[model samples]
Target chain A: MTPALELSSIEGGYEPGLPILRGASLAVAPGEIVALLGPNGAGKSTLVKAAAGLVPIWSGQVFLNGRDITRTPAHRMVQEGLGFVPQTENIFANLSVLENLQLAAALVPKDRRGELSKMFALFPDLERLRKLPAGRLSGGQRQMLAVARALVASPSVLMLDEPSAGLSPKLIGVVFERLQAVREAGVTILLVEQNVKAALAIADRAAVLVEGRERLVGAAADLAQDPRLAGLYLGAGLEAA
Target chain B: MLQLLADGLVVGSVIALGAVGLTLTYSILRFANFGQGEFLTWGAYLAVTALGFVVAVTGGGVMQPIGPFSFGWELLVAMVIAAALTAGLALLVDWLLFQRLRARGAAITLVIASFGAALALRNLLQFLYGTLPEYYTREIQIAIRLVPRDVLGGLRITPDQLLVIGMTGAVVLGLHLLLTRTTLGRAMRATAMNPALARVAGVDVAAVIRATWIIGAALAAVAGVFAGLVGQIRPGLGFELLLPLFAAAILGGIGSVWGAVLGGFIVGLAESFSVPIFGAEYRAATAFLVLIAILLLRPNGLFGEKP
Candidate 1:
């Protein structure tokens, strides 16, 4: 089967001197949940941004569903069945919850409105608060709203950058539950997470990002089982392994 | 005297018309454009010349009224031409000056540049028309009297003032409908609230700004024409009008349409009323005073959210 997302040795940066993602590469097939794991400042967000067309890629090419989209702007990416939810400032505070989703729906292919309506059933909470201003939403509710906004577009592949970043543990569980529901719907999902163990437990595939580079790539179970992950992530220092 | 208020309503009507343009520009462009005032002056002058030429060709005179109510076809035609020309000229300014500045990521500098633009436009008008105060040949024959007989020694409302008030209502009505019920209008509001987000949502921002310039400058031009007809026509016509026009925009909320209209009439009436107590020379200055007072009390004009 064709990979949903394929990054072939991409090198990208916001500035000339310091490249954010340097010759990093990864791929995921449709209906798969892939976890991108890293320590803080590992260029994980940078890699996702470059692939999403937010960051400028100085070298290499990116492909979405086998089509080359190396230099496509973010909005065009949205049109091409790719949706990105950034790690920060993901929603317009002044607009109503319904307005945000309406904007996303406005981008959907006209023929797929029926399918889009089915997708909206995944997050019923959003429907309840649709008319409320986005600013008034709780941290968890806002994250849900952000995801719902993107999902309303009925994108083929969704890239979420730390969707659970600011949420409480209970909310994080709720967020992942929604992700599992999304994965069940046959859409490919690529997620970046600092919460390593939980993400690994849920992911089919995993990639470890270092400073502008990918240090390891493997099955999520294999990475989680490896003893070194405790030291690489946990502040108790690297345990003898 | 009641005559002062009748005159107040007249002056207020003119200010409301002129100020709407400035307010709309402020809302769409997200800046206080000092040059907006000069568009009014240019519009007025253009109408004077264009309509005068039309009348000359038609063999009409100031002695004859166009119909029963107001100025002739010459005035109406000139007003339309002036509005179109001003909008065109404003686009030129946007292309040559403000557009590049925005692209370069210059914010405050653009505000200062607008001031420079206003000054340049003013001086250019002075050069072409000379410093003389010119008037449109009065073509209207009817005089509408509404004031009580005992008040301020026979106060009267001119046909021009009545027409201006009516025009103001029509302009506001047209603008409201356009903004609320159209796709282009919705896109403009979306862009104004958040430009980057609007672009991401498939709005053509460049086109919106261009349309905004056209709308804003057109209003300014018509306002300029009314001011000339109501009072005098000169290079300083717009310059003097700026403060009160801005007062209305600020009063309405810098970017809000309803706010601009409300602010326009308020500043207009304030300036007119002040004329009685402080003399006609103090008219323009009254706008600033009211603005300062509003700034102290609300600081966001009357209806606008703080920027």
Candidate 2:
């Protein structure tokens, strides 16, 4: 079966001639959560951002459900059923929670605008604080709102860049639980995360990126037990073993 | 005191309209567009030209006074046409200049380019309309005393000034609704706050930028026409108001619409009230003083969030 989202030999970065992602590639299967794990400067976020069309791709191909979308503008990605959530400043803080969701929903075609009530149902705290400015939300609640904003467009695949970055362990668990619920709701997820253990717990598959490329790809259950996973993060080449 | 209040409000209406555009452009585009004043100038001159065309087409009768106002349906129609044309001019400037500069990804460069664009636009207006001041109508509008001389120094306002104040209120209200209730408005606010996130959420940011120019320039046009009606139109009209416009935008908070309106009025009132103590020569100085005070006390502006 074709992957829901595919990045092939991607090389990109913020500026030309200074690539952060060098030949990184990954494929996320439909209806499965694939966590993109990597250490600092591993180009994990860069890989997903390039696929989402936020970062410029120097040379690569990004396929969404088998359709080439490498040259698609970032704004058009949503209409094409691809959603991205940045790690920082992901939510429009100046906008109220309802306005944030409403703004996202308004961008998609009327038929594809997923029910706001469904999102509010999934994140009940958001429904309670719907009228509050997103800036005022707690760390975990902001993450929930960011996830809900991306989900509001009803994209086929959602890519999140470090949703668990600033949250407490308990909040991370709460957020991870919500991600599981989101996956059960039938959306493919490519999550870029630093909290490896929490991410692996929910992800069916995980790709470990090292030095701008995915150096390891395995089932989450097996990878969690593999000693090489820790080595890859420690900057020790797998080939050295 | 009442007369000063009335005069201040009349002036405030124009500043408010201009500042709203400035604030919106600053919020969304992330640049202090020095060329904004030229839009006001262009709008005024465009109305002057459109009004002439309208009067010529419909005959001299269209120029007849409507009720207490000095202008008739001809000027009103001209104001609408000028507004559309001014919006077009703004789009053209964006396409020909700002868009290319935007691709370079430098805010300071855009600001510098706007200064250049402003010079070009102002000079072009001068070339077309000349340095002599023009008026929409030569009809004299007598100021009506609304209060007795004993009551708080009384109040007197011309019909044109009243119209300016009334129209400003209506336009600002419409804008408020558009920002708070409409999808496009929210998109603008979103784009202003976080453009990258807005794009990922599926907002066509380029289209939003274009819409912003249209709305901002269109309001500038209305303000221009009102300025021409209340006083005289000249190539330097907008340039003259540029200081107060920036003062109002910053005072109200660089991104807030209502803040601009309130800032405009405060600046206008301060200037009017200052004339008594500081003399007419220092009217413009009051805006700078208010701007400095606001900067010192509330750097984030009245409505702006801490950066």
Candidate 3:
């Protein structure tokens, strides 16, 4: 099957000459959850941002289900079935939870704007706190609101940058469960995570990256036991024990 | 005191309308937009020109005063035409100037460009209409006493003053509903809060920018027409009001609509009351003094979040 999102030999960065992603590439199949695990400065986030059209892709083709979306403006990518939730400022902090969802749904056609009820059903806590500003919510609740906000647009693929970053362990569990539920509902997910164990638990495949390059890619269960990941994450090669 | 209050309300209404547009543009675009005052000048001149055209084309039939008000139906029609034209001018300026500066991505550059635009626009008005002041109507209508002299030192207001206050109330209420109750408003708030996140969520940000200019310029046009109704219109009219308008916007909180309205009243009241204390010559100085005090006391203004 053609991957829902394919980034082949991508090279890009915030500026024209200083490329952070140098020939970095990854692909995720339809309805699959792919976890991109890497240390700080691994260019994982840049890879996804390049794919989302947020960063300038100097020389690489980003294909969404075989359709070239390279150079597509960030705002137009959503209509083409790409939804990106950044690690920070993902939800409108000043806006109420309900308003956040409504604003996302506005991107779709008028007839397709009834995703509020569906989102509320998925996150009942958000329904109760619908009137509160997202800023007032706890760290965990804000993350949930952010994810629900991205889902409100009903994109074919959802890309999140470190949804578990700064989240409590219990909240992280809840977020992973929500990601699984999203996958079961037929939407593919590409997650950039620092929490390798938690990510592998929900992801279909795990890709380990280092220094703007993919170091390893395989089944999540197999990659979970790989010694190289331990070495790469610690920034020191692991000794045989 | 009651007389000052009445005068303050009329002045406050014009400031409130102009401040709303100022705050809106400032919030979404992240620039002070020094050129915004010219929107007021342009609106006033446009309304007068439009009214002139209508009177000339119709042989002055529509120029007859309607009851107590000096303005006829032509003035009302002219205000609408002015608003539309002003909105168009705003969009045109955004496209021709601000949009290009925005693409280059420096807040200071945009501010400098706005100042350049302001100078150009104000001069263009002066070149076209001359520096001499103009009025919407030549007729001077007497103020009607609203409060008895024995009970409250005799508070009085003109028909046009009442209209300014009424229209300000209506426009502010309508804007409140738009920002709080509509999807477009939510998108605007979201964009103001985080442009990148709003775009990622699928908002047509360009469309939002266009709408912002339209709404902001339209409100400015109404305020300009009211300013002309209440006072005289000259090339320097908008420039003279610029400092007070900024004072009101900062006093209300930079990005909050309700804050702008309250700030307008506070600034207007300060100016009106200062006429007795500091004399009329220092009225503009009082407005700047109030702004400095607010900044010293509450750096975030009344409703602004601390940067």
Candidate 4:
């Protein structure tokens, strides 16, 4: 299948010549969830930021469904079916929960607005908290709000950075289960996750990043059992475990 | 003591009007505009010019008599003209300066630029209208009795003071109702909380900004006109009022309407009481003193939220 989000020879960061990504490139096929497993500070965030057009790519090009969008603004990119749910500080704290969803819908067309109800259906708590301020939400509820915000745009590709961060064990199960439902709904998902086992279980394919470079790329279960991965990163962390 | 209260209420009304403008812009625009007081001055000066036109057209000699009410309709005419003129100027200021600054992500720079705009506008008024003081021709003001003489010490009043207090009360009540019970006001409040989020929710920020300028400038003009009628009118009428006007706004809280209204009367009473304790020259100094006290006691003004 043709890749939905194609990144080739992509290099970017906050400044010129001093790139954080270091020639990083990857792709996500339509109706597939690709887990990008990496250690902390392995340029995972940098790659996602660049793909979302928040940071300029210094050298390489980015394509969305075969169309070039190397210079689009982050808001406009949301309209073109590329959704980014950042790690933190994503939703406006003072705005109402319903307002947060409506804001996401601003990037979408009016005709496609029936999906808004479908969005609220996915997050029952947010529907209940629709008139209440977003600041009143719990950490788990807030993450769900952020995720629901991006998904409301009905994007073809959704990039989530560490969806399970700062959540309880029970909340983590609920979040991953919702993500599974999202993947089943046929949107391409490119995830940056630290939970290797949970991510690999849902992912069709995976890319292993170590120190700002793609160390290995393979089928999800194959890399999960790879001897090199087992010895280098996970195996090392697991040895103590 | 009674005369001071009466005079204080009249001046307090002007402050309340001016403070409404200051606070409205502060809430909607989310910035402390140091230049609004000068707009009040400009509004007064414009009122005189509007009065001149009214006289030339009707040959009624500038200050028209208010039929048997012991008041002047000339001041009434000036107020309307002043409100219209200042509202237009306010719109122009946003179109050229503040709006572009907002679009370019220059919040602090826009605040500073409003000061520059204020200085330029103030100087332009000074150049056009010289330093001489003027006022509407004096008419017999029939006092509305509230208390008889020799009741605790003494209680006296004037029709002008009663009129001023009456008008100020009406405007405040009207504005309070408008803010509490309007769709546009609700949208304006939401925009103030977060502009980006407001845009995402499909609120037209430009329309809201325009309305803000109009309301702010109109309130300033109302204060300016009344001040001219009660006190001596001058080219620096608005400039002189700025310190106390802004003091009221800060005391009320940066973005709270109720806070601004309460702050206005508190300031009026303070200025009145201070004149006996500190002398007439120190009247304006009270604004600065209040600022220092607020900084030490309540930095967000009485109405502002906890930092």
**At residue B71, what lDDT does model 3 achieve?**
88
Cα RMSD for candidates in order: 4.1, 1.2, 1.8, 5.6
Model 2, B27-126: lDDT tens digits are 9999999988889999999999999999998975458889999888899899999999999999999999999989886999999999999999999999
List the candidate numbers ranked by TM-score, top first.
2, 3, 1, 4
User: What does DockQ give for each predicted structure?
Assistant: 0.26, 0.89, 0.83, 0.14
Deviation of model 2 at B81, angstroms: 1.1
What TM-score does the predicted chain A of each candidate obtain versus native chain A?
0.93, 0.98, 0.95, 0.92
Q: Which ten residues in a row have the lowest lDDT in candidate 1 chain A?
A: A232-241
Which lDDT tens digits does candidate 1 get at residues B147-172? 66776666677777778878888988
C-alpha DockQ for predicted model 3:
0.83
Native-referenced Cα lDDT, model 3? 0.89
Question: Model 2 chain B — which ten-residue stretch has the worst lDDT?
Answer: B56-65
- lDDT by residue (A1-241, candidate 3, tens digit) is 8999998898889988887888888999999999999889989999998888788899879999989999999988888888888998789998999889888888776754547888888888999999998889998888889989888878889999999989889999998898899899889999999999999999999898877778889999999988888888878633431
The ten-residue window of minimal lDDT in model 1 chain B covers B61-70
Model 2, residue A95: displacement in angstroms?
0.6
Q: For model 3, what share of native contacts is present?
A: 0.87
Q: DockQ winner among the candidates?
A: 2
Query: Where is model 1 more than 4 Å wrong at Cα?
Result: A104-120, A183-186, A197-203, A227-241, B1-29, B46-68, B72-81, B128-137, B147-156, B177-180
Tell me the TM-score that candidate 3 gets on chain A alone: 0.95
* Alpha carbon deviation, residue A184, candidate 4 (Å): 4.5
Error of 3 at A177 (Å): 0.9
Pairs with backbone N, CA or C atoms under 3 Å apart (clashes), candidate 3: B252-B259
Q: Residue B70, candidate 1: how far off, in angstroms?
A: 2.0
Model 3: per-residue Cα lDDT at residue B2:
95
By TM-score, the best candidate is 2
